[model samples]
Target: MRVSSYVIGAPLSDERFYLLLHGIRGTLDKVPARTGAFLVENRGKPLVSPPWDSDDRARAHLTERGYLTDLPEENERQLLVEVATALHDAALALRPPSFFFVPAYTCNLRCPYCFQPHEMHAGRGVYAKIMSHEQVDDAFRVIDHFDRPGALAEHLDLSQEGQGTADSGSVRRGALGLFGGEPLQEQTRDVIGHIARRAAERGATLRAVTNAVQLDLFTDLLGPDGLAELQITLDGMSDLHDRRRVGPRFRKTFQRIVDNIDLALARGARVMVRVNVDRSNADELARMNAFFLERGWGSHRAFSAEAAVVTGDAGRETLVTRPELVEVLDTIRADQESCLASYEGYAHGVLSRALSGRYPFTQVANCGAETGMLMFDPRGDVYSCWDEVGFAEHRVGTYHGGTLHLDHEAARAWLSRFPGAIDQCSRCPYALIHTSGCAKQARDNTGSLFAAACEGFQSYFPRTLATIYEQVESCLLGEAERPGPRPPTRTLPIVDVTHGRTRPPRDEVLR
Candidate 1:
């Protein structure tokens, strides 16, 4: 017998109890120090003797909980790959594909930290083109090809049991999204409305990720019956946000955006405000929430504000390490209502799922791109990832002249980019949670889509887990069994956000 390579545990405040999470099975429990120490000491090592001795109950617990397995390391790795692949296959068989249309790659704002080159937004480059009615119809043709009965079954090889048989009704209708260079601009308003109408005809929800500077121009189409959701960005208060998200000719945009948000909310549209935080704007988060409250935006059931760590091309000095960002969020949540300053932080999401007792399946890919997402740009180019848009070489296919052409080789690479296929990631304890991070990061950092792009998950996971574990301990254990007060939150040393161990130094952590 050997300790499972997927078992990871963090010692609780009591020191005598440890929180254990099985990476493969997603089972969580609190084990005594003896069990934790034994598992830790024997991890990845062969068990020459029965550590439990005659304690058959202890042995049974270890095996049944997936902490111990008799399979060799290579076999265990293969098992994980098989399990993850089967889960993905089943998911692909059941879910419809989601489409994102980038009307243009040109934006009105020149946010200093924007990742796209300034030339891309200059409206004179390859991105100068906008989606035309012909292109829109062509894109829908491609979508129709997928939505056709038995089309999904053609792609999925459901030869194995439990990998549900694909049928005409297997994959339901999907969603539509408007992406950028600024999808909601004055010039693109007509095309945006057309996209909404087509989405409505197909019964697909339409969403847009926009700066909201041009939102007023699209108010006629903003509501529950039109563009159902709008994801807007507000960096900070008016002064700080205006300075960061500068508009054309240095126009102030804070008030304009807030007014548009109000208009959208009043029109019955759901709005999600994304506050990108770095060292420069981290301290202003609470004040920003206060601003939202004063505007009465938070009072709307459909209105939400969340913090996101900024990793744009801003100066490294202005970027806060992942641990620092966590501390900032913890303080904000402590100071304000939980809903007032919430961040959909990766660690928090994983911990929530772990504690759910639902035995969530391990994540197969980093994001939807590897599953059912396809991004079609104005040039009729298709890409698996949004970050790869406008990069001609990264496109998975081209749809032009009402004909769809897919480079199966390129699409296959993205579909196969999962944790179990990466080298070090295949054995890492958190592989299932991080799922090898972002695939675009892998292509940029390692020059390959199949490689692991951890992006600080190692450092970020442990620190965030420790902090959140303390905050939610009461929910995990009975009052009589709960441990003492958690120790002070500790920050792990900063890890460069480039290599597999970290994120890109200048890109947002999309999750």
Candidate 2:
């Protein structure tokens, strides 16, 4: 199966892009004929079709015919030709990304859920020292090398057997992400400004994730006519958010963040709100949504809501079970439904599947790690996902001597850690749909993905399934009742980090 060039920009509109056969069954039946027919009729189309009803049928037919053929000459030859043609067409249609990591890992908040909290502490910084000007230059050099036509040519040559050409136009180049202990830190502002200026010089875009406390300072850097996107975190309403975020002045900090966000949006900068959901704040998330809607913030060009599973201490053993987390998620979803109908909201786990052809919210026995996004650290360590920050082997590369690049071998090694299948998950029908479980969490908790899936299946899967069952039952019984009054706003006890032990939960982390 192959995709057409027309599908490059508008993939959803051009259904032909879905034709790639990746071992899934009954895909052709689902593919729209208009797309398939368009490809077949287009004389210059590079795809080769076998004598079959659809691309899926053609693939199956080839595989069956090859398997049935007697000797190497007949079977291998035909199979090789078919595979080569499919790959060549795919290469032509493929669009590789140009991602960069701007050097800075400082963040202002010491939220319990963050994976990179080590970067913020005075002595034990998660990342090396703030990126020096030399380091910034090195980052630019690496990006420039990738942007060069020769680099693209080499990438294509290494990727496919001279089947396609990579041009400057075909490569999507943009600003590296603004990451830091706190990107807006006084020390890192210059680095952020330097990156913005450099991006303008090179005609690239600026994209960064921040807590938004210092966003006001960076507005000039965004400017007009520059590509920009900022992801800011606001876990819940002021009371609840302040409890979890634990800043010196919670109310003032949040207000400043909101003000900066408004300023950025007023200036045409794209902004996305990333709410890290945990047991404590899940109930308040809906209130937060209401907060956004009431302010008319939902209508902005770059406005959207993203929910992510909390990692680190938030994902610890005693905090809450998977079932409880799912329950929180359900409540959050129901509350936001009204707002979502009028605006855009995304759950991280479901969004990935929704964006891809993969099923959202369904269980999967196993899936490839390549199906997920890779988190690149400033020092060049590549993680399977953002949550696996502390694991050593998951580190894919480093930028010491020269540019460290990830290869197929490295990818395979990383993928090998996650068990593809196990009896418990395989027997469970949701396995293929949900894609097993999070590999990083599994490895950290159980030392293997399969074990993680199994444990998750036993511990959390039942709750998730039960929740669905309850929801379905509720629909049968009529509209489900809304959850009770918002839990008394409790202040979290500030753990003395100097002593390294958590204090008992309090009404507020701050006084």
Candidate 3:
């Protein structure tokens, strides 16, 4: 019997449940085998338990709950139409192309994991030139290409509506982000000013990512309203951090950063702290969260820290093993739950397991490159993401030499290769969700995207499941042993990975 959709009203009895189950199978038999596989494989079993004895048992449970149904064939067509409609709605919600402007390439410190290692060697004595006023105009020309076509149509619509001639869709300005060597550097103010002014004229919001050292200097560019969001980097607490991110005033630098953040917060400007997690600093992540909580910043805004498995030039063989990293993530999750109400324990746990090689399908699916967060270099060179920095072909465009362009089609084509690029991932059940894996890691380690994903899954999956089990067990123990007030949470400060590799010269050090 051909079925489309099923509807059930009122409370379900065992008898009704079984009837519905049989009907669903009858209808589903006509559906594709792949659909059957997906239902049976991915979302079939609860992670908390072993597999059910039989499909009958599963079906019975579903039917008893009144969740299972067999729909008429016509209803299936309607369901498809609804799904397509929802997809179209979602597509329309996404922001259109704005621009990420990188004004300089010089940074203050030599970070060990920084993709641009050459910049460190160049040292503080060398200043990377900021864009000239003429260059600023040229950059605007690029921005105009994206904004004007849509803006002109939008203007026409606004005029028509005002005059009662026509009704048109509302057009809101998009976002523009500033990048660096260190964008807050003294020299780049003009570049920032120019962009901020143009953004104001076009009704766009200006955002910036800075190290926060020279954030105060940009107050003029921020104007009375200030930036939409300012992202700052803080690796860890002072002692641990100063050891890694060594400079003339390491202690004062971080203190000033925190001070600046407090000032920004008081003024109604958004401040986000971006902590880059690596093997060395992974253990301290929970402590960092606790530190934030003490300062009252954890609850006021979004507090998040990301784990990045070192890749490209920085991904050495001796870094934290996949299993070790999973352990660190579990600790992070547990710590985060103390203060944050909406902690993603299970999801991140799953990701950790995938990263550790416990889950078969836990491969890298959506690298930032494919997800539209493209990286830009000091000279306007485009890369897929931060890690895949050196590839010649991936350079989609550049601003130098009077040629500035982006091949959107080419970019899409490159991203499309992420799935089915690796053999193990292609055959794995989770391939669709994860895609192939981290292309930069794959290329760096195994020299093949497929190999990298497969290896990562092998390492991440088992450990992740084990970690989850342990966490659950710990919770049970806590309930049984000392169930009073929970212990206070601690936030570990970020430790910069690039400081104190060598002693300062005699002349540079104070007696």
Best candidate, lDDT:
1
Per-prediction backbone clash count: 6, 30, 38
Residues 1-511 of candidate 1: C-alpha lDDT, one tens digit per residue: 8889888776677878777777787777778877876786677777656556678898889889989889899888877777667656654555555677899898899887776777888777687898997789889877866763324334533224555444654444544777877889888987887888787787776777788898889877888778777777888889898998886754799989989999999998888777776778888877987777777776667776666565534677777765576667667666664443332244555676677766555456567666646678988789877766788988988988666677877876766667767877778777777777777767777788888866566665655665566667765665433221122121111112221112211111122
Model 2 per-residue lDDT at 407:
55
The list of candidate 1 runs beyond 4 A from truth reads: 37-42, 46-59, 148-165, 169-171, 340-356, 462-511
TM-score of each: 0.85, 0.59, 0.61
List model 2 lDDT by residue over 103-130, tens digit each: 5554556665554455443325455556
> Any idea how many clashes model 3 has?
38
TM-score ranking of the models: 1, 3, 2
The CA lDDT at 270 in model 3 is: 65
- Note the Cα lDDT for every prediction shown: 0.68, 0.45, 0.44
For 255-301, candidate 3 gives per-residue lDDT tens digits of 77778777666665666565555667666567766777788886664
Q: What would the TM-score be for candidate 3 when compared with the true structure? A: 0.61
